[model samples]
Target: MSPQHRLTDLPATARAVIEDRTGPLTSVDMLSAGLNSPIAARLLLDDGTSIFVKGMRTDHRWVWTQQREADINRHTQGLAPRVLWHLTGQGWDLLGFEHIDGVHANYTPGSPHLPLVLQTMSSLAATTAPSSIDLKTMPQRMSAYVDDPRALTAFDGSTLLHTDWKPDNVLITGNRARLVDWGWASRGAAWIDPALWVIWLIASGHTPHQAETQVRAHPAWNTALVPSIDAFTRAQARMWESIARTDTPGQWTHHMHQAALTWAKHRQ
Candidate 1:
């Protein structure tokens, strides 16, 4: 019921398209505090059905990113949001899907979510490129990650990476766990995603030491090099800072360019 529950930066065209699809929207609200794209105040349709919507830019990388995510979400069976639309006509670039009632995995995790969270990492990682020999989407690979600590180490690029795999990206409903927001995902080393999530947890409130323990305890990143994990966490902190200062989407370009150098170092 507060201002945080309403969408603010949406263009007029996006709002209209959403209205055209869902009928007259009511109780327009927004979810606040995230760094990437804005996702809030899900639209409710005529039958009392609701769908989450996120208005984004037309960056080809982002276009590729969201398209891949939509595929992965549906492919994961139930661990993600369904992609109902990506409105490009109205500067909306909307993504509509079923509304979820779970909260973000922001704090130290407990049972189901924790176990499944690790499992999801393993699952996504299982699909990474067979070899790190030639990595595509290099921009998302490591260029923007220059500020990340993991930039100092080599990323195998063989495992499927949920590049934005943080606690906030994981949603839990009852004992069930569903991974969401695969926008920055790719095929990379084992610890990349888990390491990213751990740093976010630590920087947000969780202690770095404890976060390292938690990440190491996970079967996915646990098998990875401890030093690489550390560097990854360091770089992730820097990336998060960049995200916080993201006044416009254009900065994402600089972020990737810087990260490329870091990721390239890991050619080994």
Candidate 2:
């Protein structure tokens, strides 16, 4: 089976470059769906080196974002898949990451192992990194996109911020936890990672009470506790508004709104 993609919109030269990189890609099959960006899957070279390629919106592509992932994985000591290449030319940007090996964590409600996973996350968070990413100016719209304002405000200076620490962003295997997709990484407030983790926990299936309680039990999450629920509420409302405007009319969105309301009610 081969991967399938829709890159007819890319420039001729860019398409050729993509094909050249995947040399003899032969064909493609849908590997994953509903991603925010266009993606393609290419086979691992005879050397056992494979890459996941993605094209990003031109205006939003930045070197800092690409370098951040490279640096984070570099410090991860192989906890993260190696970033094979990153190219930003031809008014288009592409990121090539070594394929990940495990499924994203699935947090079933009341799962006994939830606590252990979070504890492990805190331990991973404690690891100091040699790479220092600059965030003197990250996109101002982050507060608008993320559901936590406190999380964004924590971005006062430079810290190891894996801004998108959702469950889907984490890959766990055989007691080893690896972090991926550092696209939204920032500096300032290491708690940023766990804070994102908290949101993902609740979103995945755990109740707010469960997420809040268990996360706080970890010393790392304590520092990044939601300082202002008021701000978070504002962010949540904005998230719903944005989704309503952008997402296509569909059942998933129906569930999205339902989920938002359910989460909000859980808070009350």
Best by lDDT: 1
Backbone-clash count (model 2): 9
Tens digits of lDDT, candidate 2, 1-268: 0112345344555556665665544443324532344444544553455666665545743434555666566655555677777676666567777776666666667764565567566665665544454443322544655555446664443445565554556676666666666656555455545544555566667676776676776665555444433344445545655666565666344444445555556655
Give model 2's TM-score versus the native structure: 0.68
Compared with the true structure, the alpha-carbon lDDT of candidate 2 equals 0.55
- Tell me the spans in candidate 1 whose CA falls farther than 4 Å from its real position: 1-6, 9-12, 24-27, 57-65, 109-116, 129-140, 143-153, 230-268
Model 1, 1-268: lDDT tens digits are 0111334755567678887776776656666644456444566676788787765656523455556555556455555767776555554456777788887764553433556666666666666443422234433545665655345446655565666654567887766667776666566666676766654444444454555566676566657665665455445545545644544545433443233324333322
State TM-scores per candidate.
0.68, 0.68
| lDDT of every model, 2 decimals | 0.57, 0.55
- Separate clash counts for every candidate: 29, 9
* Per-model RMSD to reference: 7.2, 5.5
